[model samples]
Target: MQKRATFRNLWLASAFIAPQLLLVFVFFYWPTAQAAYWAVTLEPAFGGGNQFVGLENFRAVFADANYWASVGASLLFAVGCTAVAVGAALVLALFADRGLRGHRLYRFTFFLPYAVPAAAVGLTFRFIFSPDAGLLAGINHVVPGLWNPALDGNDAFVLVLLGQSWKMIGYNFVFLLAALQNLPRTTIEAAAMDGAGVLRRMWDLQVPLLTPTLFFLLMVNITDSFVDSFALIDVTTHGGPARATMLMVYKIYLDGFESKDYSLAAAQSMVLMALIIGLTVIQFRVVERRVHYR
Candidate 1:
């Protein structure tokens, strides 16, 4: 009877998970397998006219200067956004860890932006910082032309950074604040009793203990900036006047959708996948050695 019950339970468990398994196989695994296969071959002429040429697509991807430049730009944007967002989140998390008045409300306010749609953020920011008749243009009256991306290359680059960081700050803060809140209060009090000032406690105690959370957030943030922030850049800059903001994903989108070059876009996407996977593996290798999960 017990053996029969165990089998029944296993059947029920599998039944419960079947839908999710189906969805994963249909959407994610199948699409990934197809894309990877497509990456190796030129898209055939409509109605199956072309032959499979393995590795040539990858070779072409490597030989393309524009592809390399777009990838470099994407890396630059990801690194810059990660630095700003993570640093800001750490500071904000520290602040929220203290029992300040209306702290919960403040935390909610900071995290609210993350819940907002990325496409909306991109659209709103684009209008808010337009060359003419934008909110930023109005602010220039008091701030003495503080928003001028039109005339300066450096300023435009900075605007992209600011937009990306603004969108990501809340997302990082949520994870960081959770980590801070979960930390041992007694340990912090003990540190204080031992004459450890705020900075010292943070540097010596909180940070070391929070390494696992920090590493997780860092990986997520970088990966997000790499792939998910395309909407923000697409709406704000459209890769911009001189391709200053031409992230690799944007290039892929342009090639795939805009130019209808499926083969080229597939190649670009494959390269991106390689980059993300390689970096993630390296990060895990290094971080897992030191990450303190407890």
Candidate 2:
């Protein structure tokens, strides 16, 4: 049986949650409502007045070829970062779970990246990949003009993708490591008793058991790849080299702030929000069926 606590007064209960409610209203709901309104309305870029446009902004967004290109770039960025980050995190978590030498130090060092700011990580990578004095600049010496991300569209996309992936690995590693530690040891022992090697045990036993956590991470990583990469892209590539790295989030910033098109930016932001919501719903409805919750 579950025990329940009753408040002596209804007002007291309301008072307890009032602050949190106020915060949500102020920070989340209010801004969302404003964005939704702005999406459908035309507001002067210089803040003169708002005129109800009724989807004109959205039509304009769809008609722009650059918008479609941005969508394609965002998809590539999302897939690349999610795959690399999740794969690398899983491998590192597996090794860390083995109780090997210096495991504690390794775990600490690996998770440290999560604490660092994304802007700093982007700047660091920008320098590391710079064609002229970067650590990778030696590659240019070996093959003339072959290592310049600033001038090559593919290289720019790759640099942003790698930077985003590296920053996200630590976050995925922490959760995966915790999930691994909590898994049943008897299952692993039984597998070993049956002559299953480490690789076989991990692939056949541990992976199935980890499906729930893996599914959760997949949803989170995909959504984050769409939204959380704005800072990194801004700092590193700024959607340069023919807009190869201009993700949806960065495109919104570029359109609204740089181009001074508030209504268009708001429309794009609403579209992005809808896309994330639709993807999350699909994941829960379709992907959740395969998750083995123990």
Candidate 3:
């Protein structure tokens, strides 16, 4: 009787999960499998002649100078956006975690940008940085070329990094703020009673407990920056000013869909997937053990 009851419960659970499992298989696994298959082959000739050219697509990727440049630019963009966004968010979260007047209003103000669509954010930033007759240009009158983020390669790179970071800061802050708000107050009070200054308590007590949340946010922010910034890049600069901000996803978009080189795009995408997977693995291996929560 117990065995029958257990089997019935398992069946009920499977029934409830079936739709989600099927959706994952259809949407995620199927497309991933197709991309992986295409990454190993050249575009097949029409009329019933297709050859499996193993690893040639990836070989071409390695041999292409433009591909390497795009990869480097992508790495730079990801690191820059992640560092700035996460650092700024961490600071904001820590400051706001304290009981300040109008804290709710301040939280809303910071999180407002996260609600803006990425395309809109990019377009808005472009207008702000336009050479003349823009809000930033008006500010530049007093600040002197402060909005010239597109004048050259270096300037363009800086503009994209800052724009992306600004868009991401709110999202990162929300996560860190939740972590901080949920932290145990007893330990913080105890530390304060022990005559620990804010910095000392943060360094010795709070940060140790916050490490897991910080690591998780860092991983997610980096991955999202790499994968989702394609739309922002496309709308803002189109990887412009001589490929200065031509990141990996933008390259994949141009190569696969725009240039219609599906094989090359798939290969590039596989490389990105590998990089993200490796980073996630490292996060678990090295960072997870150090996380402390009481």
Clash-forming residue pairs, model 1: none
Full candidate order by TM-score, most accurate first: 2, 3, 1
Candidate number with greatest lDDT: 2
Cα lDDT tens digits for candidate 2, 1-294: 555975579898899999999999999999999999989998775767798999999999999999999999999888888899999999888878889899999888897888888899899999999998979999999999998898999999999889888988999999999999999999899989999999888788877877777777887888988988888888888898888888999999988899988889999999999999988997887555754432
Q: Estimate each model's TM-score.
A: 0.86, 0.92, 0.87
**Candidate 3 segments exceeding 4 Å error:** 1-15, 45-47, 138-151, 284-294
Candidate 1, residues 1-294: lDDT per residue as tens digits?
A: 246444558778999999999999999889877777777777566676445888888788889887788878887888898999898988888878776898989788998878777778877776777666777787677777666666555566667777778888998888888888888899999999999999899888988888777877788788888888788877677787577788888888998899987777888888888888987997787676755532
Predicted candidate 3 versus true structure: per-residue lDDT over 1-294, tens digit per residue:
246444558778989999999999999999988899889877665635445889999999999999898888988888898899989988888888886897898788887788888888888877777767666678677878765656567767877788888988999888888988888899999999999998788778877777787887788878888888877887878887788888998999999888898888999989999999998997887564654422
Clashing pairs in 3: none
Q: Which stretches of candidate 2 lie over 4 Å from their true place?
A: 1-3, 44-49, 282-294
Ranking by lDDT: 2, 3, 1
RMSD of each: 3.7, 2.5, 3.4
Model 1, TM vs. native: 0.86
